[model samples]
Target: MSANRYPLEVDVAIVGSGPTSAAYARILSELAPEARIAMFEVGPSISNPPGAHVKNIGDPAARAAAQRASEGPGAGAATVNSPGEVKAGTRQARPGTFLLTEGYAADGEDGLPVAAMSSNVGGMGAHWTGACPRPGGAERIGFLDDLDALLAEAERLLGVTTQAFEQAPLPQKVRELLAAQVDQDRVAEYRVQPMPLAVHRRPEGQLVWSGADVVMGEATRNNENFTLFDNSLVRRVLTDGAAASGVELSDQLTGQQYQVAARCVVVGADALRTPQLLWASGIRPEALGRYLNDQAQVVFASRLRGVEASQGAGAPGAGLSEQSGVSWVPYTDEEPFHGQIMQLDASPVPLADDDPVVPGSIVGLGLFCAKDLSAQDRVEFDDQVPDFYGMPSMRIHYRLSEADHQVIERAKQQIVRLGHAVGDPLDERPFVMPPGSSLHYQGTTRMGTADDGTSVCSPDSEVWQVPGLFVAGNGVIPTATACNPTLTSVALAVRGARRIAEKLNNSLLMSKSDNRMSE
Candidate 1:
């Protein structure tokens, strides 16, 4: 649709076209096919043919060029270079190409920076590694009811499977060798299995998953009522008294401001921006941006000594191949950290016959420990210094607690032990990734059983102060889960969408009844 054809109002207006909003839009559209839905995205709509810039994931130069070409002229550069700017760095993945245009703030105390939230249409889902593990009982939020059903539905929607590379020889042998070193009690407790991934095998047996775009792209494309406004940055939720009336949006290309009147609004703008929008609109609950939490990750890389060069052949870039699989060590009561072991196909070493060991066969182990939700670790909006979108830039204040530090220490010891058991350890010690580098930020707009000032939203993900406003994303997850929070967050969004659908349906019925009475 052309920019002139964009609707002035919608029954449902969703901010942020990430996984959470995509899931909500999918479910709600199915429930009410006749309803008008508008999804606003701050980044370019590059997923479509004209702007398909994500062609090469392995080639950094190609990816960067593609991203730059997609942005066109006048788009600002990415504010963050790497997670290291905020003291957070990732060993497995490099800085994203599309994230170059996004903005983030640095902390004054430790100088650790928060992960740059993607302003693109797909949000962070486009750049994620596709690891989708369900949170265990210990990791689930205590107040979230119907957890089992929600997870099941979420799994179905994500097409999660645990057999992506189950038949791989190297990963199997590594797991077996590692299990032999640990006692049966500990082995059973940890329960290492094939990592659950949101991917599917093609007819030629290649694994692929195109994030939320694949999940709901067809639905949005087919449904004319569902409209997408890309390169539209949402400034704030326009509220009338205690109720949300619409949203103020800015065209990133033209720098034109517009209002999108909505009967109901859902904000899935990630952890930082979600609260920033709320705070910008003067909806400052005490816990609006407090209780921020992200998994504390520790990463270690090792080379598999004595492995034949031929055996490590065909490993795809960014690690997993037909011959190698990824393993997950779920969080247990005894060990409160989630662990993963995967082959790094993007290792810097070259594969050659002369070398004693196979090059590019570096296996990486990652430990993600759940951090306690604390008010002290939060995001502050600096309205004085506006970003390119003319909104307040964020300043993150995050510090690892004593418990988090202890978990990292324990995880380091375990990584060393496993390294010796699997292969020759390369680095002197494992590197502790900076906080927020995990890209699993949660608990900012947490849902609670009550509307107390401590919680930003109710159990149904409805804002306590706003009747027709809702929130969906990782920020709504109240628990500090060690596992990847994407699936859990999507599950919560599904639940919220159902509630919103029911409310909208009931309102429609009431309007008809009132019209009949007036006649």
Candidate 2:
């Protein structure tokens, strides 16, 4: 697109093309219909529909190829490593995903050695597992004036549905068994049910996972005011005094730079890069990259007590199609960690090279513990070292507190109980993954009630001192949550985008009044 023409000015300049940015694009374009929106993505479009989830690809080889296209900066190449060789560490080593340390070979170098991210039009939305569970108990954000309304709106945008696995017989049984285990723990208040997913299930049993494309709504096709620029990286957020003026972006394919002026700038470039870009622009807030936190994950597998190991629906190597499992135990104050139980066609845990999971013989359980947020844990940038993209090189500083460890221990105990309720634990039993394994990192550019040193943004996701500058994605979430953060992140971005639209509308009114007075 840049080969033909470039946008010199836009009403809104979105820095990343992901779920959060999609939320911003959706609300801003609809409310501020006259506002021009230009969304810049650093990675090329890997799928046919620019922002479609790669999981929608039917062919295994093609899906793997798509993932190869979006591998993180650290991923050198997708090698055909055996399951034992590509051990699921802090983050699961799926065919398409790789750890942040993959290219560096710097395991144990940081608190979050396995932290990983993909680069593409949909951002993490393209690779996410599509879990869209609602936050409960301590997981909910407190500073918001009204959170329920925002969450509902976000769900609508993502096309969240419980029907993803409604017809699958295995999930109901797994849910009932997990619910029984919860009852035994005397925390039945925390319901156990099929995971709420961002998916559209067709009548013929095809599952369509929602990525940024779903939230973009009509903006992806019909809106003339919206434009998505793939393979473009936002270098800096341009500001005039305290107001955000626009952004300086460069084509990743070509080294050409283009300045797109705008009334507002919203950076939803994931948790890690969002702060890096803000720091590069010298918007160095006291909490620019502080309060970096992620949920501690403990995963285990077990063979079902009653069900026989048969080639089931979507099992790998089975003559059937595939459908990923989505079910969990809702987070509760009593049980600080959330329990995720799923009946994958294959076992999630592989105790050995010939792990029964390969034979589709067992169910998998994952426990995610929300960490204790602290200022000491941070992501520091080095000016001397420019990263692969020429941005300030990033180093994550993270540590699980003693309390966080105890939370993990409690989670292990709960998972054991749940494991026993449905099936016997596999030989590997329960184990804690390395830091950042949860991959749901949050709170770097966190939103607070005030512009205090503790937070980078205000309650509305606007940068504290930078009036027209805003931040979104997992970074802006201030809460320590156990549920997947996508739904919540989108909700907050929607709130912020709405505020942006309101301001744009007000500015237009003021301009109209001035013209009438001159007449």
TM-scores for candidates 1 onward, in order: 0.87, 0.91
| Tens digit per residue, CA lDDT, model 1, 1-519 | 255435788889999888888888888878877778999888876555211215324566755544453432223445344323323333222333222132333435432343545556677666566677878857887776698788888887777888766666677777776676554666453566777877665565556554677546466568888888888888889888889888988887787778888988999988878998998888888888888888877777677766776776664443235665667778875777887776664222221122343433567778898886688777778778875567787677777778878887988888778777777776657777755567788888998888777789988898998988999899998887889898898899988889988988888899999999999
RMSD of each: 4.3, 3.3
Global lDDT scores for all candidate models: 0.71, 0.78
lDDT of 2 by residue, 231-250 (tens): 89899999999889999888
* Leading candidate by lDDT: 2
Give the runs in model 2 whose Cα sits over 4 Å from its true position.
Answer: 1-4, 75-110, 184-189, 202-205, 308-311, 314-324, 346-361, 516-519
Clashing pairs for predicted structure model 1, backbone only? 78-100, 86-112, 86-113, 88-434, 319-345
Candidate 2 TM-score to native: 0.91
lDDT of 2 at 463: 96
lDDT of 2: 0.78
